[model samples]
Target: MFSERRERLRERCSGAGVDAALVSAPANVRWLTGVPGAEALLLERDRALIAVAHPARDRDEAIEELVVPPGQDPAVAVATAAHAELLGVEEHDLTVARHRAVTDAAHCRLRDLHHAVEQLRVVKDDQELACLRIAAEIADQALGELLESILVGRSERHLAMELERRMVDHGADGPAFPVRVGAGDHSGRARHLPGDRRVEEGDFLTVSLGACYRGYRSSATRTFVVGLAPQDWQVELHGIVFAAQRAARETLAVGTSLDDCARAAGRVLEARGYPPELDEGVGHGVGLDVEEEPRPGALEPWPGEFGKLENRVPVTVGLGVALPGRGGVRIEDTLVVRPSEDGGPELLTITTKELLAL
Candidate 1:
C-alpha cells in the first residue's frame, strides 16, 4: 500500500520535472510511511530514504532507513541526501530556518512541491476509508455512551475529558482533536473550548469530538438540551441547523464543487435569518488529519478556489447556529462522496442527528 503511494508520488515528481522530493510535514510523512517519527523522507527515481534519530524504532517497512549521526539534524541529513538536478520540497510546511538549512545542504536547485502530498491525499483508498469508518464508529460510540450517563451537573471540562477517555477505551489511538463540550451560551459554536461552565437545567449542550484510528480520523458533533425537555426556541434552532446539515450532506457527490455544498447549506441558513458571515458552511476533507483539504475557497475567484468533490473522498458536513443567552444547535457527520450510479454519499457517522433531551 505504501509502495503504491510512493510510486504515484514519483510519477508526480517526474511529471513536474523534479529529480527527487523531500517531505517534512508530519502528516505527509505518516501517509507515505507508516512511522510518524520526527523524520524526513527523501525519494529519488528508484530509491527512498527515511532519516530519523532513532533507527531501532523504525516502523515503516516500505523504505530504507538512515539514522542521523548523534547531534546531526535529521532534516539536514535527509535534505543533503537528495542529489537530483532539481529537488522538490514541501515549502508550505518547512520553516524558514529549516528551509535555509535544507538549501545549504542541497546539491541541486530546490522547487516548491506546492502541497503535492496533500493533493495526493485528497482521495481515499479502501484501507484509508476503512480506518476512517472505524474512527467514526469509535467517536459515535463514545458520544452514545455519554448521553446515557448523568449529565445534569457535569462540568464541560469533565464531559470533554470523559468523551476523550471513551474514544480511547473504544480502541482509538487517541482523540483526533480536542474533545469539546460546551454548555450554556457557548453551545453550537464550531469549536468551543471546554471550560468550567457546569451543565444546568434547560441549558444547551454541544459535544464535538472525533477518534483517530490508525492514521485516519473522523469527526462528529451533536447538540442536546440538558433538561428533561427542550424549549420551543431550542427545537426551532435545532430543526434549522439539522436542515442545513442535511442540505450540505445531500449536496455532496462525485464531481460536485465544494461551493455547491457551501451554497446549498448557506441558502437554508440565509433563508431563515442567518447572517452571511455566520454561514461557515459545513464540510471538509478528512483522512490522516481530521481537517485536511476542500476548505472554503478564496474570496477572489481563481483556479482551485473551491475544490471539486471526488469519489472515495471523505468529508464532514457540520453546521452551527446560536443565539446568545438562548443557546444554539450544531449537528455534524462524516461521510464519503460517491457516485449515484454506485450509490449516493455514504454516511459514516450513524449517530442520530435528532436533538436529544438529556
Candidate 2:
C-alpha cells in the first residue's frame, strides 16, 4: 500500500516537471512511508529516502532513512543526497527558511507539491475504510456506555472525560478529537468546550466525539433531551436539525456535487426559519486527519470547484444551528460514500438519530 502511494506521488511529480519530491509534511510523509513523527523528510527517488532528525519507531522497516547530524536540515540532506535537479517541495508545509535552506543546499529548482499527498489520501482503500469503521464502532460503544450511566448532576467536563476514557477502553488509540459536552443553552453550539456546567433536568444535551484507530479517524455527534421528556422547544429544534442532517445524508450519492448536498440541508433550515447567517456548510472529509479535504465551507479551488462525491471516501455530515442563550441541536455521522447499488452510503456511526429523552 505504501509503495503504491509512493509510485503515484512520483508519477504526479513527473507530471509536475519534477523527477524528485521532498515531502516534509508529517502526514504526507506517513502516507508515502509508514513512519509517523515530526521533522521527517522524504526524498522520492529510485527508492524513497527518509531523513529523520530524531529517532522514530519503524515497525515495518518498509522505507530507508538517513539520520541527520545535530544541526543539518533533514530536507537538505535528503534532497542533496538524492542529487535532485528539479524537485517538488510541499510549498504550504515547508517554512520559507526551510525552503531557502533546501534550495541553497540542494541547488534544485523547487516546484510546489500543491497538496499532492492530501489529494491522494482523501480517498480510502478498503483497509483504510475497515479501520475507520472500527474507529466509528469504538466511538459508538463509548457513547453507548455513556448513555447507559446515571446522568443527573454530572458536570460536562466529567462526562467528556468519561467518554474519552471509554473510547480508550473500547480500544481506540485515543479520542479522534476532544470530547465535547454541552448542556442547556450550550447544547448544539458547534465545537463547544466542556466546562463546569452540570447536567440538569429539562436541559438539552449535546455530545460530539469520535475515536481514532490505527491512525484512521471517524466523527459522530448526538444531542438529546434531559429528564423524563424533552420540552417543546427542545423537540422542535432537534427535529429541525435532524431533518437537515437527513436531507444532507440522503443527498450523498456517488458522483453528486458536494455543493448540492450542502444546499439541500441549508435550504431545509432556511425554510424552517433558522437563521441563514449561522449556516456552516454541512460537512467534510475524514480519515487520517479529522477534517481534511472536501470541507464544504472552506476554499473552492476553481469553477464548479465543489468536488464530486466519490465511492469509498468517508465523510461526516454534521449540521447544527444555535440561537444564543438557547440550547441547540447537532447531528453528525461518519459515512462512506458508496453507490446505491452497494446499498447506498454505508452509515458507520449508527447510534439511533432519534432525539432521546433521558
Candidate 3:
C-alpha cells in the first residue's frame, strides 16, 4: 500500500520535471512509508529510503532506512545521499534554515513540490477509509457515553479531559485533537478552549471532539441542553443550525465547490435572520490529520478559492452560531464524498444531531 503511494508521488515528481523527491512532512512520510516515526523519505526513480531518529521503534522491513545521528537533521541526511541531479522538496514543510542545510548537503537544484502529496491524499483508499471509519466510531461511542452521564456541575475542562480518556478507552490511539467543551456563553464558539466554567441547568453544552485510529482522524460536534427540556429559543436556534449544516452536507457531490457548500448553508441561516458570517467556512477535509486539504472558508468570490469536492475524499461539514451572553448550538459531522449511485456521501460520525435535553 505504501509502495503504491510512493509510486504515485514519484509520478507527480517526474511530471513536475524533477529527477528525485524528498518528502519531509511527518504526515507525508507516514503516508508514503506507513511508519509514523519516519522523519524523511528520499524517493528516486527506482529506490526509496526513509530516515528516522530511532529506527528500531517502528520499522517497515519493505523500505530501506537510515538512522540519523543525534542532533542531525533527517532531511539533510537524506539529501546528502541523493543520486539525482534535481530534487523536489516539500517547500511548505521545510524551514529556511533546514532548506539551506539541505541545499548545502545536496549538489542538486531544489524544486518546490507544493502540496503534491496532499493533493494525492485528498482521495483515500479503502484501507484509509476503514481506519477513518473506526476513528469516527470511537469518537461517537465516547460522546454517547458522556451524554448518558450526569453533566450538570461538571467544569468544561473536566468534561474535555473525560472525553479524551473515553476515546482512548474506546480503542483510539488518542483524541484526534484537544477535546473542546463549552458551557453556557462559551457554547458553539469554534475551537473554544475548555474552561473552569461549570455546566448549569438549561445551559447549552457543546462538545466537539474526534478520535485518532491508526493515524486516521475524525471530527464531530454536538450541542445539548443541560436541563430536562430546551427553551423555545434554544430549539429554534438548533433547528436553524441543523438545517444549515444539512444544506451544506447535501452539497457534497463530485465537483461541487467549497464556496457553493458554504453558500448553501449560509442561505439557510440568513433566511432565518442569522448573519452571513455565522460560520467562517462550511467544512474541510479530514484524514491523517484532523484537518487536511480542500479547506473551504466563507463565501469568497474568488474562483476556485478552495477547489471542488472529489469522490472518496472525507470532509467535515460543521456549522455553529453563538449568541453573545447566551448559549448557542453547533453541529458537525465527518463524511466521505461518494457518488449518488454509490450511496451518496457516507456519514461516519453516527452521533445523533438531535438537540438532546440532558
Candidate 4:
C-alpha cells in the first residue's frame, strides 16, 4: 500500500513537471510511507529516501533512511541529497526560513507540491476504513459509559477529563481532539473550553468528542437535558438540529456537490427561524488529520471550492445553534460516503441522536 502511494505521488510530480518531490507534512509522510514521525520523504523516479532524527521502531525496508546529525534540518539534508533538476516541495507546510535553507542546500529548482498528498488522502481503502470503524466504536463506548454514571453535579472540566480518560481506557491512542463538555449557556457552541461551570438541572449539556485509533479518527456530538424531562424549547431545538444533520447525511452520495449537502441542512435550520449564517459547513473529510480535505464552507483555497463527495471517503457532518442566554443543541456524526446501492453513507458513530433527559 505504501509503495503504491509513493508511485502515485511520483506520477503527480511527473505531471507537475518535476523530477522528484519532497514531502514534509507528518500526515502526508505517514500516508505515503506508512512510517510515522518521518521528518521528510524524498521521492525520486526509481527510489525513495526518508530522513529522521532516530530509527523508527517499526521500519519499512523499501525506502533508504538517512539519519540527520545533531541540529541538522532533515528537510535540508533530504533536499541536498536529491539528484533531480526540478524538485517539488510542500510549500504550505515548510516555513519561509526552512524553505530558504532547503533552496540554499539543493542543486535543483523548487516547485510547490501544494495539497497533492492531502488530495490523495481524501479517499480511504479497506484498511483505513477498518481503523476508522474501530475509532468510532471506541468513542461510542466511552460516551455510553459516561452516560450511565451520574452527571448532574459534574463540572464541565471534570466531564471533559473523564471522557478523555474513558476513551483511553477503551483502547484509543488518545482523544482525537480535546473532549468538549459544555453546560447551560455554554452548550451548543462549536468549540467550547471546559470550565468550572457545573451541569445543573434543566440545563442543556453538550458533549463533543472523538477517539484516535491506529492513526484514524471519529467524531461525535450529543446534547442532553439534565433534568427528568426536557423543556419544550429544548426538544424543538434538538429536533431541528437532528433533522438538519440527517438531511446533510442523506445528501452525501458519490458525486454529490459538497455545498449542496451544507445547503440542505442550512435550509432546514433557516426554516426553523435560526440565523441564516451557517458558519461551519455540514461536514468535512476526516482521516489522519481530524479534519483534512473536501471541506464544505471552508475559507481556505477560497470558499465554495470543496468540489464534491466521493465514495469511500470518511467525513463528519456537524451542525448546531447557540442562543446567547439560553443553551442550544449540536448533533454530529462520522460517516463514510457510499453509493445508494451500497447502502448509502455508512455511519461510523452509532450513538443515538435522541434528546435524552438525564
Candidate 5:
C-alpha cells in the first residue's frame, strides 16, 4: 500500500529536479513507509532508504535491528549512505538544530521541500478513504452513546471528557480534536473551549467532536434542546441552521469551488435573517491533521484564497448560528467530494441531523 505512495513521491522529486529528497514529516513518513515511529525516508533516483531511531523493517514484516553508533543522527546517516548530490528536506517540519546537523553531515546544498508531500496528500486514495470512513463510524458511535445517557446538570468539561473516553473505547487512536460541548449561551461558538458550565434544563446544548482511526479523522456536530420542551426560538434556529447545513452539503461536488459551498450555506443563513456575526470559514479539509487543505469561504482565506474542490478530497461542512445571550445551533459533517455522476458528495459522518430534545 505504501510502496505506491513512495514511488509517486520519488517521481515528484525527479520532476522537481531534486536528486534526492528526505521526508521527515511524521504524517508524510507514515504515508510513504507505513512505519509508525520517528523515522525519515531518503528518496533517490533509483532507490529509497528509511532511517529511524530504531531499526527499519518491511511494511508487512517485523522490525529488524540495525547497528548504529550512539548519539548519531539517523537523518545524517541516511543522507551520507544515499550519497545525495543535493539533499531536499522539509524545512517546515525539521527543527533549526536538526537542519543544521543534517546540512553539516551531507556536505551538499540543502533545499527546502516545503509542503510537497502535504500537497500530494490533499487528494485521498481508496485506503485513506476507508480509514476516514471508519473514523467517522467511531465518532458516530461515541456520540450516539452520549445521547442515550442523561445529560442534564453534567458539566461541559465532563461531557467532553466522556466523549473522548468513549471514542477511545470504540477503537479510536484518540480524539481527532478537542471535544466541543457548549451549553446555554456558549453554544454555536466556533472552536469553543469546553468549560465547567453545567447543563441546564432550558439551555441549548451543542456538541462537536470527532475520532481518529488509523491516523485519519472525521468530525460531526449536533445541537439539541436540554429540557422536556424547546422554546419556539430554539426550534426555529435549529431548523434554519439545519437547512443551511443541508444546502451546503447538497452543493458539495468535485467541480464546486470552495467559495460556492460557503456561499450556498451563507445564502440560506442570510435568507433566514441570521447571518453569522463572526465570519469564520464554513468548512475545511480533513485528513491526517484535524484540519488540512481546501479551506472554504471568503473568511480565513489561504494565501491563494479558497481553491477549487477536487475529487476524493474529504472536507467538513459546518454551519453555526450564535445568537448572543440566547445560545445558538451548529451542525456539521465530514464528506468526500465526488463527481455528480458518481452520486454527488459521499457523506462520511452519518449521525442524524434532526434536532432532538434530550
Candidate 6:
C-alpha cells in the first residue's frame, strides 16, 4: 500500500514540473513510507531514493527495506550524489538554516514543494481510512468509559487526563490534540485548554478530544449536563448545536463544497439568534495531522483553491453555541466523505450525541 503511495507521490511531483522533490514533513514522510522512522524521500520522475535514520536493532530489522544509515544527511547526500536538478523541498517545514544546508549541498536550483505533497494526501486510500477508523473507535471507547464514571465533582483537567490515558491504553499512538474539558463559563469554547475547574451541578461540561492511530487521527466532542436537573437554557442550547452539527455532517459528500457545508451549519446557528463563529469553519480535513486541509467556511472560495472533498476523505464536523456569561454547548464528530452510493458520509466516531444529564 505504501509503495503504491510513494509511486503516486512521484507521479505528482513529476506532473508539478519539478525534476525531483525532497519530502521533509514528518506527516508527508510517513504517508509515502510505511516506516515511522525519521526518513526523507528524494523523489524523481524515474526513481525515488528514500533515506531513513539509523535505528535500533529492532527498528533497523523492522525497517530494513527503507533504512538509510546514520551520519548521512539524507537530502544533501542524495541531492549531491544523484546529480538531480531542480530539487523541490517543503519550504513550510524546513527552516531557513536547513534550507540553506540543502541548497549548499544541492548542485541545482532548489524550489518549494509547498503544499504539493499535502495536496496529494488530501484523498485517502483504504489503509489511511482504516487507520482513521480505528482512531475514532479508540476515542469513542475512551469517551464511553468516561461517561460511565462519576462526573459530579472531578476537575476538568483530571477528566481530560484520564480520557487521554484511556485512549493510549486502548491502542492509540497518542492523543491527536490536547484534550479539551471545559466546564461552566468555559463550555462551548473550541479547543479550550483543560483546567482545574471542577464539574458542578447545573454546569455544562463540554469535552472535545481525539486519538491518533498509526498516523491518522479522529476527533469527537460531546457536551453533558453535570447535575441531576438541567437548566432549560442548557437543554435548548445543546439541541441547537446538535442539530447544526448533524446538518453539517449530512451535507458531506464527494462534490459538496466546503463553504456549503459550513454555511449549512452556520445558518442554523444564525437563525437561532446565536452569533456565528464562522472563523473556525465548520470543520477541517483530518489525516496524518490533527488538522490537515480543506477548511469549510463562508470566506473560503468555492471550487476550493486548496482542494475539494473527494471520496474517502476524512473530516471533522464541529459546531458550537457559546452564550456569553452563560455556559455553551458544542458537538462534533469525525466522518469520512464517501460517494452518495456508499451511504454518503461514514461516521467514524460513534458515541451517541444525546445530551447526557449525569
TM-score of each: 0.94, 0.92, 0.95, 0.95, 0.89, 0.90
Q: Which stretches of candidate 6 lie over 4 Å from their true place?
A: 45-47, 56-82, 297-306
Error of 3 at 118 (Å): 0.5
Per-residue lDDT over 127-146 for candidate 5, one digit per residue giving the tens place of the 0 to 100 score: 89999999999999999999
lDDT of 2 by residue, 16-82 (tens): 8788888887667876776765355555557778887666665446567787887877777777776
- Per-residue lDDT tens digits of candidate 4, residues 1-358? 9999999999888998999998988889888988776888999998889998888787787988999987998899998889999899988899999999999888779999878899889899999999999999999999999999999889999999999999999999999999999999999988899999999999999999999998888999999999899989998999998898889889989988667888999888889888746678777889988988877745344343457788999999888988899979988999999999999999999999999888
Native-to-model Cα distance after best TM-score fit, residue 147 in candidate 6, in Å: 1.0
Please write out the lDDT profile of model 1 over residues 63-145, one tens digit for every residue.
Answer: 88888877776767988777788989988888898888998999678999878888888888888899999999999999999
- Cα lDDT of model 3 by residue, 80-117, tens digit: 99998889998889999999999999998999887888
- By TM-score, is 1 or 4 better? 4
Model 6 lDDT tens row, 1-358: 6667767776766776777888888888788766677567676666666676655344422222345567766666656544567888889888897788789888788888767767778888887889999999999999999989988789999999999999999999999998999999999988689888888888998999999999788999889888787788988898889888888888888888667787888888888877777677878889999888766544333343744688988888888888787779888898999999989999999998988887
Instruction: Give per-residue lDDT, candidate 1, residue 275.
Output: 68
Off by over 4 Å in 5: 51-82, 276-278, 297-306
What number of clashing residue pairs does each candidate have, in the order they appear? Answer: 0, 0, 0, 0, 0, 0
Better of 5 and 6 by TM-score: 6
lDDT against the true structure, per candidate, is 0.85, 0.83, 0.90, 0.89, 0.82, 0.81
* lDDT for predicted candidate 6 compared with the true structure: 0.81
Per-residue lDDT of 285 in model 4: 84
Model 2 weakest lDDT span, ten residues long: 297-306
Position 201, candidate 5: lDDT:
95
Ranking by TM-score: 4, 3, 1, 2, 6, 5
Model 3 regions more than 4 Å off: 57-59, 297-306
Candidate 1: TM-score?
0.94
Displacement of residue 63 (Cα, Å) in model 3 is 1.4
